[model samples]
Target chain A: MLKIENLQARIEEKEILRGINLDIKPGEVHAIMGPNGSGKSTLASVLAGREDYEVTGGSVDFLGKDLLELSPEDRAKEGLFLAFQYPVEIPGVSTTNFMKTALNEKRKYHGLDPLDAAQFLKLMKEKMKLVQIDQALLSRSLNEGFSGGEKKRNEIFQMAMLEPKLAILDETDSGLDIDALRIVANGVNQLRSKDNSFLVVTHYQRLLEYIVPDYVHVLYKGRIVKSGTKDLALELEERGYDFIKEEVDQAIA
Target chain B: MDVKSNLKTAYSQQEGNSTHLASFQTENWKTFSGMGIPALKHEEWKYIPVKNIFKDEMNIAIESSNLEDTIIKKSILPGTEEANTIVFFNGRFQADHSIIHEKDALVVKSLETAAGDEDALFVEEHLGHSQAYHPDGVNALNGAFASGGAFIKLKKGKSLLQPLIIYHFSDSSNGFRFSQPRILASIEANAQITIVETYINIGGGESFTNEVIEICTGRDSITRYIKLQNEGKHSNHTGTTHVRQLERSNTHAVTITLDGAIVRNNLNMVMEDEHAESHMYGLYLLNGNTIADNHTIVDNRMPHCESNELYKGIMDDQSTGVFNGKIFVRKDSQKTNAYQSNKNILIGDQASANTKPQLEIFADDVKCSHGCTIGKLDEDALFYLRARGISEKNAKALLLQAFASDILGQIEHEAIKNYIEQLISERLSFQA
Candidate 1:
């Protein structure tokens, strides 16, 4: 479903993702556990086609197409979703309107009919409940004055509404309370299907306990230095990143 | 070009004759000619040069028989068809096009006609009265010419179901035309009325319009005014509006300046009675070389009065925008609450905005606050939209439109609100 070859990226002349490669197939969930500055968010931003990040070298392919060459909107139309760690607050625009426009745009790109008002409202009600989002909150401006937990849940609600084939949860648990974390993870787990895949990026293993991953990789300094199954996340949780750093350094020596 | 030069000389010569000019027309002409047009050196006119606009020779406003008749056929506010409608051509009121209804409840007539009457005394009282609040040359120039203004009076305990729509059309085929439209609206105690005024330039030639409006609201009266200015690129407009709450009234006014070459608007609200309330909202969308300047003042002179104001501007290209909002809580006005805010967006690298939200509070028990913000589009918001399958252009347009919707939502008329939405969208290239 996704492929990256020699992915070299930088921001403001500072090299972040230096020659890293990763691949994911359908029905597979990949967990990327990285320290504070291991280019975890950079990888998600590059995949999402954020213009500020310069892809200095290499290419990214998604669904057998040149992902790096596509614009951000086109990449989204091709079924790429990024659950931002910090959701933007767009005042005066209601969440319903924003989500409807986005969902229709993606649908139009896929050669589908735009949802009418009634149909759109029905879908919104269903998905909003699944994410435990308040209906009154959705009626207000988009993410305006929203709490951190509410913004994360809203993001998950949108991911459910759009149903993108490839979803990247970029540190979705960073600011969420335990309850919000459960709700967000439950929403993701409910939407899980064999045809869709997720790239979960986080620093803690608490979120992984709820939304289990198929594979866990430790990203150290822009490159993945260790790969294992779900147990690796638990081990890292019990031992912390220092154990992994020592192992990586000894291996390099 | 020679026409402009000749017009300048003609205007200067007329200034000399204006002093002796009989108050037979309006004593205002003398006041306007006495002060003349202001220059950039003046503190109030520092950003705008009113002198250079008239430096070239232009055509004196002439009555046009070929004026477009279909213009008055359109109503700016819904339900105005059954109400009184006043039409102005090149700054002169057209009686033949004027319509009136509700004879016993309302009195609608031209300023010249009302000036000749004493019983309809509001004409003499509030006509050009904004000068007391705004002493600038622009207000003086508008008051100096006393012709073609509209007069409206509402009887006590009367409520107008339909609004009064005023259309001020500027046509400059003869050359550069200058128009002065003075309007006086006086509502008696327990009366209610809504007025929607809009301007559109028809001809290709340059036109300069200076207009003043003075409103008086009696005890427990309610007045709502909506001003829309969408003049063409070659037009220049300077408008002043003065509103006074005589004895505890409620007033709401919104001004939307969508497009123009050079547009200036001055709005002043004086709360003279206790427990009065006022709200003012302004929005301007400018591109190209257009410049829009808005200056507003709210004075709380009585105890327990409140006023809130918000002005937003969206500028692009080489266009420039300015907003100066001032609020005053006089020493006698105890328990006054006033709030003012101005926000602007600069879409182009060359586009700029200058905003000053000022508050002067002398009452110890009053609460006053003012703030201003100027910024480019929020990148995080833009990317959030782009990542949702909206193209970059569309994303920016959405955010820009949202930035404007706060003020547009204040429009009480749904059709007018939709029209502004379409206009803003067209300017953003979001849709054809």
Candidate 2:
């Protein structure tokens, strides 16, 4: 579903993602694990088209279209979703209103008629049950004073609402407690289908325990140095990223 | 054609035999002459320049109180069909255009008649209570020419089924127009009511409106007041909504200033008895060269009283917004709780906001807090919305509306609230 070849990027004077190459097919969930400052989050941001980063080199293609040419909103309209590391707290806008706007806009891009009030609410209820989100929480402001778990579950709820072709989870497990992690992972697992894919970016392999990625790639110093199966995640969790760094340094030497 | 002499000419034209009201008007005229119009050097009117707004050739209407029915019909708010519609043409109460839904529940009369009616003593005692809080010319200036104002009285223990909509219409087609509208509302004991005041400028020329509304709530009474100002750039306004809460009474006031050339509002909440509660809220969303100045005062005179105030504004283009909120707890008012907050957002390079929240607590045992903030839109929040398939313009508009929702929530009337929301959405559509 997504192809990234030598995806080099930087912010200001600091180089973050350097020569990253990754490809994910339909129905696949790929996990990228790295130490802090290893460009894991930067890769997710670059894919989602955050304007602050300079694309120095390389291109990202999603569904045979040049993803770099689209605006952030247009990218979403084209079925690209990025679950932010820290969901913004927008007071006064209910989660219901937010999702309605996003869903309607995405539907418009597909040349579909906008959903009426009853239709939107019904769809929201179905997705809400799948994500295990309380009905009262959806009536309040968007992520305003939401718990760490509620924020992640809301992201999954939005994913269900949009049914995107590609969803990038950036540090979705950063602040989650054990229970919250389980709920969030269950939500993602329920939404997994044959046509959609996910790029799970995390520093700890603990998140991989629940989602169980198909491909485990170790990122170091802005490059993907190693790739293997699910057992590689347990191996990295056992030995940490230091062993991967040493392996990359020896390969360069 | 000086402003003071023009005011004198208007004051001397009243043929009424109400000696007490005449004497009160004379004193205020003296005060207006002594204080003149505040200049840049004055502290209260520092940001508001009153000198440029007063033209020597402006005509103050006295006989054109007959407002057209069609015009009055167009000026009514959305859900006000069942309301007691009170129309004021050029600051004079037009009985023909006004409606009294329930004569037993409410009594609407002119200030001239109120002075000679059964409520004469109550009117005389509380006529100029707002002037006591200000020694400046602005409050007193409106008092100097308090001609043809409305007097609204709620019968004791009787609640009205519909709200009261007061429309202040200024027809400046003849030339420049000046209006001084005065309102006195007495909500008797155990009575409850809502009063919504809106402005209308029907002409193309310059208009200056100086209005003062004083309300008194008796024991166990509840009053909700909403003031909406959406006049054109040719109109300059200085208005005040002064509310006094008696023993065990409650009052809530919301001031919304959308657009005008120069607009200044003074909202005063005076708590006179124990266990009294009051609330004051204001939202000023402006663009162009519009200037909105909101000054609020919550005076806690008795013990065990509480007052809460919140005012938010969004300024764009070259527009400027100013907020000055003050809470005063007297020495005898122990255990008083007063809180005030003012926040603003500047959406343009030339847009500006100045906020000052002050608390004056003479009692050592009281609790009072005041705060103010001025900033631009949050970039992170903007990005969050855009990443969800929303345009940058729509994102900012949504976030701003969200920021304004808490203030909008205070409007008890759904039609008026939705109408204001619609106006704000249109105003914010062009903003990024």
Candidate 3:
């Protein structure tokens, strides 16, 4: 469902994502693991069309369309979602209201009629149960004073509402407690289907244990040097990334 | 002829029209002539070009108003049909066009009539009281025409069934029109009232309105005042709302400016008695070449007085917004508390904002805090919204609406608040 070939990107003078290649079929999950400053988040940002990063060279194809040519909003409308590591706090905008706007905008882009109030509320109530989120939290300003767990759960709730074809979880477990991690993973598991895919980006392997990935790739120095099945994540968790670094250094030498 | 020569001619024409305000008008005319229009060098008037607004020859003479009742009725704010309506056309109070639903709760009269009647003492004590704080030609210019103003008083221990709505209309079809509408209101002891002031302009010619409304609250009384200015791009306005708490009273004021050529508002709260409290809130949402300038002052004259002030601005296009807040804690006003904040967002590249906070405290036991900020829209916040499938335009509208909701929430009157909210949403092209 998504493909990236030699996705070379940089931020200002620093080259971050250098010569990376990845391909994911529908109904599959791919986990990209790396150490600090290994360009894991940079790849996610580049795929989501964040303007701060410049794609010096590469191509991204999502369901036969060039993803890089679309604006951030257009990319979202085209069923591309990015769960930010740090959710923004927007004052005076209730999460419920924001989600309604976003859902309707996506519908309008696909030549579908906007959902009525009753229809929208009904859908929201159904999704609220999936993520174990409270209606009161959604009624308040979006993440204005939310706790770490609440913020992560709210991101998953938004993901459920949008129902994107490909959702990139960028460090969704960074600050979440164990309970929040379980809830988020469960929500993603419920939403997974044969027509949708996910890219799980993380520095730690704990998240992979809950939503086990079909494939695990180790990213080092902006390049994926190792790829294997789910067992690779368990191996990395036990041995740490130093072994991977040593192997890459020896190969370069 | 220039505005100064025309004003001089008008002043000479009404020199000997003996009335209750003859001496007051003459004195104020002298002060205005002495100071003239404020130049850019004047500290308080530096950001606003008051001189340019007066460069055109204005018709200072008060011609008989021929406004239609239908137009006046159409101009009344929604959800305020039961309000006590007062109409002022071309600076003269229109008694024939006004209405008082609850006669026993309050009294409304012409300033000229009230000055010579039993309320003469009250009017004399409160009229032109804002001059002491402003001390400028703008205040004196409005003072010179005080005889054509209105006088309103709420009876002791009485509360109006509904708010009082004042509609100031100016006709500039014939030429450059100039109007001065003065109001002196007194809330008697234990009384309560809400006052709303809005402006309307007829015809397309340029118009300038200089208004002064002085309110005095008696012991334990409460007063709420709201000013809404949206008179289009051809209109210029300068208004002063001076409120004094005589004995532990409470006062609240909100000023919202949406569109105008150049608008200046002066809001002053004088806490004259112990334990008095006041709140001042303002929002100026501008686009085009509109300039909205707000100046507020809080004077804590007695002990244990408290005041809070907040003013926000959103400048789009090439618009400019200016804010100057002053707080004073006198030596006798021990244990006083005052807080002031001003925030601005410049959406256009050429849009600009100027904010200044001045605090002078002579009491060692007082607490005062003031702050100001000017910035562009939060970029991260914008990107987050865009990433949620909302168009960039819609995202900006949503963020700007949120930025303005802070001041909008301060409006206690439900209908007026909803009305202002609708105007803001329409301006931002926002659905909600």
Candidate 4:
């Protein structure tokens, strides 16, 4: 459902993602694990069409469409969802209102009628149970003064609302306790279907234990150095990433 | 004739017509002639070109024959039908057109008649009190024509359910129109009142409204004042809303400027007694070549006085916005608290904002803080909204609406607040 070839991206003069290539089919989950500053987040940002990072050389394909040519909003409308590492706090904009606008916008893009108030409220109530989010939290300003766990759960709630074909989870496990991690994972696992895919980016294997991935890829210095089954994540967690770094360095020498 | 000669002729014609305010008018006319129109070099009028607005030949003559009842009816704000309506046509108060529903609790009379009647002492003590702080030719020009103004008083210990709505209509169809509308209101002890001021201009010709509304709050009284200026691009306005809070009184003022050619507003809160409190809020949402300048002053004269002020601006296209907030803590005003903040967002490349905060704190025991910021919209917030599938245009509109919500929420009057909210929503093309 998604493919990236020779993706070379940089922010300003510093190169971040150098020669990244990945492919994922429907119903498959791929995990990208790397050490700090190994271009894992950069890869997610590039796919989400963040304008700050210039893609010097890249071609991304999503369901046979050139994804790199679309704007960030268009990409979102085209069923690409990026769960931010840190959700922005926007004052005076209620989460419910934000979600309503976003949902209607995507519906319009798909040539569908917007859901009525009753329909929207019903869908929201159903989705609220999946993420275990409170209605009062959604009524307040979006992410303004929200706790870390609440913010992540809100992100997952939005992901569920949009029901994108492909969702990218960027460091969603960071700053989350064991309980929050379990809740977030449960929500994601419930949304998983044979027609949808996920690219889970993380720094540890803790998140993988709850929502086990089909493949594990270790990124080192802007390139994936190793790929294996879900067991590789447990192996890396026990042994650390130094061994992988050493192998890549030896290969370079 | 030119505007200067025309004003001079008008002044001469009305020199001795009324003995009530003749000496006051003479003194103000002298001040206006001496200062002539304020030049750009004048510190108070540096950004606004008040002289240029008068370059065109203006008809300062008072004429109300062209104004029809239908026009007044159409111009009345929705949801304010039960309000006590006070009408002004070409700067002259139209007693025949006004309607006062709460006659027992409220008193509305012409300034000239009030100055000569039993309310003479009250009118004399409060009229032109804003001149002490402003001390400018523009303010004095309005004072020179104060005879055509209105006097409003809320009886002691009375609270009116319906607010008083003052509509200033300027008819500029014949030529460039210049109008001055002045009002002085007294809220007696333990009384409560809400005053709303809005402007309406007839015809496509350019119109200038120089207004002054002075309010005196008595002991334990509460006063709510709202100024809504949404006149067309051909209209210009300069107005002063001076409020004095006596002995534990409370005051709240909100000013909303939606559209104008060049608008300048002066809002002052003078705490004359201990434990007096006041809140000042303003929002100027502008597009096109509009210019909205707001100047606010908070003076803590007595001990234990408190004041809070917040003014926000959203400038789009070639619009310009300016804000100057001043807070003063007198030597004897110990335990005084004052806070001021001005924030602006520039949406267009050519849009600009100028903000300044002046604080003169003398009392060592007072708490005073002031801050100002001018910049573009938050890029992170914008991207966060756009990434949610909202169009860039809609995202901007949503963000701007949120930016303006802080000031809009300060309006306590439901109907007036909703009316202004609708106007702002349409201005920003924002829904929901």
Candidate 5:
């Protein structure tokens, strides 16, 4: 479903992602665990085609298409979603309107007929029930005065609406409580299918306990150093990322 | 007599001398020519440079014999079938074209005819007060050239079923023109009315509009005024609206400045009686090299009065925006609440905004606050929309529309609000 070859990216003159190479197939869920400055979010931003990040020497292929060559809108139309760590607070755009425009734009890109107002509202109601987001909240401006957990849940709600092929959860679980975490995880698990995949980028293993990734990878200094089963997340949580840094130093030496 | 003399020559060479200045008109002209167009050095006109727009000569259109019929039709409102409309061509009233039925609650006629009648006491009293409140030279110039002023008076305890639309059409095909149309409006107690005023350029050269409108709101009256300015690129406009709340009244006004080469609007509201309420909202979306400035002053002289103001600007290309809002609470004006906010979005690096919202409170028991924000479009919001498969252009338009909705929602007239919404959409879609 996704392939990254020597993904070297930078912001300004400072190199954030040195050389990242990752490969994941359909129906696979990958959890990338890293320290604070370990390029975890950088990888997500590069994959999502953020304009601020410059890919110095790398190539990203999503479903065998040149991802780096596409614009951000094209990247989104190609079924690539990035749930921002801190979702933006848009004051005037209502959540329902924003979501409807997004969904219809993506649908139009896929050559599908746009949903009418009644059908769109019906689908929104169903998705809202799945994520437990209230109807009144969707009527207000998107994240205008939302709480931390509400914003995170709203991101998940948007995910449920768009239903992207490759979902990149970038620190979405950081500000959520236990209840919201379970709800968000439940929504993601419900949307999971054999034809889709997820790249969960988080700093803690707490989110992994809920989402339960198929493979856990320790990323240090932009590169994924090790890959293992879910147990690796529990081990890393217990020992912390210092253990990974020591192992990396010893390996280099 | 340095720069002022040169300006006098410029004004005389363009507009020529008025032959009707035999009575009080000549006195007004002497008072006007004595003080040329106020420079940036003046206190009231400090933030605005008025000399640039009027540096050259501008002739008032003289040939009223040949007027374009299509220009008059195009200037009317979209769905104004029963409107009491007044058409002003080159700052002179076109009596043959204006239609004001006797049965309507509104009395629309020329200020010249209404001035000598005993029924026009309101017009006689309130005509020159705006200039008195703001004694700048440009205000005097408008008073001096007040050729064909429009008078609208709503009778006591009456509500107009239809709107009163005033169109100021500028035809400067011969040469540069200077047009001034004074407006006198008096809303009686408990009366409700909506007044829509706009400017139109029929044959464009260089046209300058120096207009003043005086409004007197009676006790418990409701008044709404909408000013829409989309003049030609060579047009320059300087408008002043001095509204007075004679008693406990409510006034809601929205000023939309969409496209203009040089536009300056001065709005002043004086709360004379207790329990008066005023709400002022403005939206200025300027593109190209256009410049728009809005300067407002709300004076709370009585007790328990409230006033709230919000002005937003979306500037692109090399356009510039300026907002200066001042709220003054007098010492005796206790229990007064005044709030003012100004926000501007600069789309390009070259686009700029100068916003200053000031509050001078002398009353200790009053609540007054003012704030201004000048920023670019939110990048995070832009990404959030674009990441949802929305095109970048549409995303920007959505964000801008949302930013403008706060002010647009204040339009009390549904048709006017819809008209503005469509205008904003068209403006956003036309990408230069």
Candidate 6:
């Protein structure tokens, strides 16, 4: 479903993603774990086509399409979703209107008729039940004065509305409590299907325990050094990323 | 000939017809010639190019207006269907074209008639009081030709059933049309009224409108005033709305400037009595070569008066925006609470925003704060919207609307507010 071959990227003059190669099939969830300054979020930002990140050398093929060539909106229309770690606080743009715009744009891209007001509200109500966000929150400005957990849940709600082919969760679990974590994880699990995939980028294994991953990779210094099953996340959580750093330094030496 | 000499010649031609106000007319015209068009070196006229707009020959269309009733009916502000409609064509009041919906609630008469007959004391006390704040030629020029202006008064202790909509239109088919419209309104004690002022330019010829509206509010009265300026790009406008609270009155004014060649608005709120409250809100959305300058003043003359002022601007293309908000707390105005803020967003490279928030407090027990901001649209906010599958254009419009909604939210009239919102959306959608 996705292919990244030596996806080297940088912000400003500082290289973040040195050379990352990853291949994932449909219906599978992949978790990339790393310490601070390990390019975990950088990799996610590059995949989502954030303008600030410069891809120095590499290729990202999503469903056989060159993903880097598309604009951010085009990438979104192509069924690429990024759950920002820190969702933006947009005052005056209500969540319902914002989601309606996205849903209509994506639907229009695929030659589908736009949903009317009642139909859109009905769909939003169903998704709100799934994401456990109240109706008032959707009516207010998007992410403006929202708690951290509410922001994460709103990201998940947006994902449910979009139903992307490739979902990239960039530190979405950092600020959520146990209850919010289960709700968010369950929403992702419910959306998981053979035609869709998720790239769960997190710093802790606690999120992996709720939504078990098919594969876990330890990323260090912008490179995914090791790949294993879900047990690897637990092991890394117990031993800490220092052991991974030592392994990387020893290998480099 | 120079603009001042041309204006002097025009003023001399009109002074001969007036009998009751001949002295008043000549005095103001002398002031206009004495002050003339202020140069750019002048502090208040620094960024404003008032001299350029007045350089050409401008003749006040004093000829009795042959405007149709249909024109006045069509020009009534939306949502004011039940309102008392007052119409102005070529700076002169069109009485036949106006409609007084409620007969006894208020009285509408010609400025001279109102000054000489009923409410003569009000005319003597409050007429041309805006000149105290704006002593420039612009203010005096409007006062110099104040004939055919409107005189509106609300009955004591009686609130109107609906709003009073004043429509100012410029029919400039003959030549470079010049209009001077003066309004003297008095709301009696315990009365309530909402006054809305909107403008329309009917002809293709270039036009300039200089308007001054002075309002006096009695004790415990509530007044809401809204000014909407959306004339075409060929028109230039300078308007002053001066409101004085006699004692413990509440006044609210909102000015929305959408488009014009050059527009200058002076909104002054004089809180003269104890516990008087006022709010001044404005929004200007400019594109093309439009320059919208909003100058507002809040004067707290007595103790315990509170005033809040906020003016915002969004300038696109090579448009320019200027916001100057001044708040004054006099020595006798102890415990006065005055707050003023101005914010602007420049959407184009050449688009410029100039903001100055001035606060002068002579009272030791006063709380006064002023702030101004000028910035470009937040690129991060733009990216966030685009990432959600909205097109770049839609995203930009959404953010700009959001930035403007705080000001747009001040409009109390539902239909008029929505109408202005539609115009703002169209203005914001422009991209080059």
Worst 10 residues of 6 chain B by lDDT: B15-24
Q: Which residue pairs collide in model 3, if any?
A: none
Distance (Å) between predicted and true CA of A141, model 6?
A: 1.3
Q: Give the C-alpha miss distance for residue B258 in model 6, angstroms.
A: 0.8
Taken over the whole model, the C-alpha lDDT of each candidate is: 0.83, 0.88, 0.92, 0.91, 0.84, 0.88
Tell me the spans in candidate 6 whose CA falls farther than 4 Å from its real position. Answer: B1-9, B13-20, B430-432
Error of 6 at B418 (Å): 0.9
Clashing pairs in 6: none
Best by lDDT: 3
Q: B1-432, model 4: which lDDT tens digit per residue? A: 777888888777653645447778889999999988888899888789888888547889866556789999898888888999999988888888889999999999998888888998887778888999999889998889988889999999999899999999999888788999988888999999999999998987899999988999999999998999999999999999999886789999999999999999999999999999999999999899998999999989999999999999999999999999999999999999899999999998999999999999999998888898999999888888888888888889888888889898998888888988888878877644
Q: Which tens-of-lDDT digit does each residue in B148-252 have in candidate 5?
A: 676778887888777777888887777777787787788889998888888987776888888889899999999988899888678889999889999999998
What does candidate 3's lDDT look like per residue over B1-432, in tens digits? Answer: 778888877766653545557778888999999998898899999888989888556878877889999999899899898899999998889999989898998899999888888998887777888999999998998888787899999999999879999999999988778999999998999999999999999987899999999999998898988999999999999999999898999998999999999999999999999999999999999999998999999999999999999899999999999999999999999999899999999998999999999999999998899999999999888989988889888899999989889899998889989999999989998742
What local lDDT does model 4 show for residue B38?
Answer: 86
- Give the alpha carbon lDDT tens digit for every residue of A1-253 in model 3: 8999999999999999989999999999999999999999999888888889999998999999999999999999999899999999999999999999999989989989999999999999999999999999999999999998899899999999999999999999998889889999999999999999999999999999899999999999999999999999999999999999999999999
DockQ of each: 0.65, 0.59, 0.72, 0.69, 0.58, 0.62
lDDT of 6 by residue, A1-253 (tens): 8999998999999999989999989999999999999999999888887889999998989887999999999999999999999999999899998888889988989999999999998999998889899999999999999999999999999999999999999999998999999999988988999989999999999999988999999889999999999999999989998998998999999
Candidate 6 chain A worst ten-residue window by lDDT = A42-51
Candidate 5, fnat value? 0.88
For DockQ, the strongest prediction is 3
Q: In model 1, what is the error at residue B426, expressed in angstroms?
A: 2.7
Candidate 1, residues A178-214, lDDT tens digits: the string is: 9999999999999899999999999999999999999
Native-structure RMSD, model 3: 1.4
Q: Model 4, which residues run further than 4 Å from truth?
A: B15-18
- Could you give the CAPRI-style class of model 2? medium
